[model samples]
Target: MKRFLSLALCASMLVASASAVSAKTYKMKIHSTGNERNQSTPPLRQFAKTVEEKTNGDVKVTIHFNGVLGGDRQATEGMQLGTIECGITTTSTLGTFDPRFNVFDLPFLFKDYETAYKAMDGELGDMLEKACLDQGLRILAWGVNGFRSISNSRKPIDVPADLGGLKIRCMENQLHVSTFKALGANPTPMSFSELYTALSQGTVDGQDNPPILTFSAKFYEVQKYYSLTRHVFSVAPLVMSENFFQRLPKEYQDVVLAAGKQYEADVRAATENLEAETIAELEKTSMKVNSINDENHKLFVEATAPIYEEAEKLVGKDIVDVARSCLNN
Candidate 1:
């Protein structure tokens, strides 16, 4: 018995030593369209720092901000093809890869940050992450794109009717288009890169985005009204190429995954903190900001309620049911 125990201990030590000695150095890039001043950028930088420190320099991480590599879709495709190591992309972009992600595009699915986090960190996120893995992408952590609001040059949107006849630039997603149509706005699906020019030239009357984006992207420079619609809550996930993630040593994989969770916490906190500050900054600019009152908020909610049925069909009843359950809890 003593000899058997001694052999087991020896084997464990040998394996641990071998793992330490055989650690491989890996260099990886994390791509994001957000620039240096974007609210999520600093947390992402810290995420890279933590990854490098935890791995004892065995893993080197470099971040390419401002879409140096490509837009969200391009970067996502690159990762899926194993040409890009990692990236952070909106669920809308991921929706194209897997239609289940379109669930996020549903209007008013999340009414607040806490509810949003609970759903994404719970079964809704787990199921979506698993579905994405089957498509060659692995979701490390789900983060926020903040709740989207409408900003138009025309007027303050106190109610659904206020958006009537406005040409709102929306993401190239069917649900978004359908939602805008329901709200009585003309949903012009356009590339984000052309938004500034379009808004400047009045090609589109306005656009809906998170307040931080309206400030960071300087959309306020062209538009006059900013309403706290908080219409749709968007999520961005830090994703890695499944192939690259699998290629890592188990210990390094653990480090990277932990770093991803840290990134989620850091970025989410940063977003929550920056939101009020971003709004204050917007208020200081030429933009007029307003919030939808409880009565008006209800009106907005009721206006888009029909989208839920469409959402169920688009992403399956189970996903929509689970997401609604998360919010109710």
Candidate 2:
């Protein structure tokens, strides 16, 4: 009887050990190139908080901001290699991994935030998410870095004509280069990490980004003119490494997706609010800010009309048509 009791106690202890091991906690490291103050950070931070709270501390997430973990491109590569678990990056750079994403970078595609959100949340978003999965990244939600605006150290760019002879810095996307080439400016594709220094040191004459980045990143101090070109709305996706995501419990996976989708509105609102306030503050500064009316805007569009054709060739006509369908409806 004593021997049987001892064996039973030993088995019970082993079972308890196994149970404790099975209940082990998970930790996630999320990365982004955006600064701590960048509009993109808050939504992700909110997601982390929601995930931690709902999971009862079963999961813990740490965020690396301000390119400390390398820029968006590097972080994405790290995610693919399992060196990192999560990342939020502009979809423009993602085309380097999946060509189909190039369609999203088409200039003048989205008229406003409403139009952009509608298209992204619809079938177009579904298509892009599938493509991301094929590239080994599972998209959690579609987010934003806002529309791009031109800021140059030279004259005000009220029209494409003003861009002549100016060496404009663009994202490392070929289509952006083609668009700028068509407009008569010299387009230089450089990594975002090097942009500010390039501008300050006069390596590039001007660059384009949202108003918030121009103000927050202190590009206004380096560049003299800010134009309301509103050329393209850069879409950012919160993505998890496919391998890492597959290893997650089903309940935790659902929490991640739910938290990601729910917090998108909060990010968008903060970004929009920042734009107006940023523009107001920038107006008080020495930078000369300008916006084109209907005519000049039309001129800018007409100049870049060939971009649609190039986009059709890059991602195929069908994908472009699908995106247009969403925009139209």
Candidate 3:
């Protein structure tokens, strides 16, 4: 009887040790709406790999790409609810949570990639991240999506007047709608999942997006012209649930945040270099690529100026001032 009791105690101790090991292992789900080959995908994959390596595989990240789980907005909602751990989505999509995100949608806000990067990596970025935290989401890093340009089946858009009467599909952001309206296009906010069908069925005459997006999504198949408007420099945000992040061990948290910064660098490099290549590829598909001259671009700038004012009211004048200073500096 003494021997049997000792054996039973040993078995119980082994089970407890196994349970403790299991508790230390964490698996996180990350969702993205882009394809596997997208510019954002490489960095995201790298982030996962780095985190696993840094943590010695204590933390694992599983990515769901091409909207497998749901669209961007839905994925964000999932993150907030703690149903999903992380997501990489556009600022426009995230505007649904905080209208302050719409500030990025202000037309011609970013002069070039360099200026935009400085703003995102500096104080303005910190402010935006804090705003997300207040809403129960942690902003891991700012990911790049490149500059947004117009693509259409009807005609080339070189200036604000050319966009007149064009029905353009935009993300569900108030600033996007206002900017498109200012540019003379009839803006219709639609979900990204339904945009392809809407464009193919002539429900929308045009849409604006980055070259990588147009090529990867095959928007060139239905579109005839690609205009280099570079109206809005877009940013993709890597976000995690604040609740989930707080629950992580300090060492695991450090691994994840460091990985996020590295991923941002990879994403920016990939997105910037791929634009010219992707545009060249799209041209081979019979899409006429048009570059807007500086004179005409000034007209577009003027038309969308009111959008900045509206956004200032929503975010704050100080934030807008800082962004403007970034542009000037």
Candidate 4:
């Protein structure tokens, strides 16, 4: 009877210990609009793994991709509402959350990856991040979305005039809408989740995205033209709910921030490595690919000059000047 009682006590203690460990674990949900296989999602998965390993399984992360949780805008809003723990959203979408971020959305704002990263890692990034924090988002790291290009079923876009009257799907940002409007294209703001179907059904003529997204989302299957517009170099932030982040233990919070920094490097590397390969894959499809010549590119730059003025009015001229300074420096 004594032996049996001792064994039972040990078993009960083990069960109680297991329950305690489970209770101590923190659960985080990360939302993404892209599919599981996209360039952005894999790095996010690595981030989750690193966070778990570093935290010794005290922090559990679950990634919801393919708009499973919601679109970028919805995910960011969820983070604000404290319903979502984390998510990926473009700076363009974030402009709605804090208009100061709209400066990144201006046409031809960033010339290359180097310029964009410089801007984000320096003064401009600091200012914008603080603005986001005020709006209830804690930006953990900045990742690449690649330079955006135009894809359509209508025709090849060799010049700004090529965009006239074409119904293009744009992100829900005033700058993007204003950009397409200036090009004479009718820009329709739509959710990322609804984009593929809208294209397949002929609801919109064409859309713009990084070549990586164009290939990953299979936009090539529905669209017949791919133009190397490289108009906007897009960057996305891996963001956490300020409320959720603040609730984490200090040690776990530090782990999360470090993991996010690693994620930024991983995502940037993935995007750069896949960019040429993705464009090559697109070329192998039915889509007609074209690039603008220097002269025509100048025309595009000239055509969108008014966007800077509009951007200044929206994001403040001081911030706009600061972004331009990034290019000069």
CA-lDDT, candidates in order = 0.91, 0.86, 0.88, 0.90
Better of 1 and 2 by TM-score: 2
lDDT of 1 by residue, 147-252 (tens): 9999999999999999999999999999999999999999999999899999999999999999888898999999999999998997999999999999888988
RMSD of each: 5.2, 1.9, 2.9, 4.4
Q: Score candidate 2 by lDDT.
A: 0.86
Measured by lDDT, the strongest candidate is 1
**Model 4 ranges with Cα > 4 A deviation:** 1-23
Clashing pairs in 2: none
The list of candidate 1 runs beyond 4 A from truth reads 1-23
TM-scores of the candidates in the order shown:
0.92, 0.94, 0.91, 0.89
User: Model 4: which residue pairs collide?
Assistant: none
Q: Residue 25: error of model 1 in Å?
A: 1.5
Clashes of each: 0, 0, 0, 0
Model 3 Cα lDDT, one tens digit per residue, 271-300: 898998998998899899999888998899
Which 10 successive residues of model 2 have the least lDDT summed? 320-329
- Residue 105, candidate 4: C-alpha displacement in angstroms: 0.9
lDDT of 4 by residue, 162-233 (tens): 999999999888889999999999999997779999999999999999999889889999999999999888
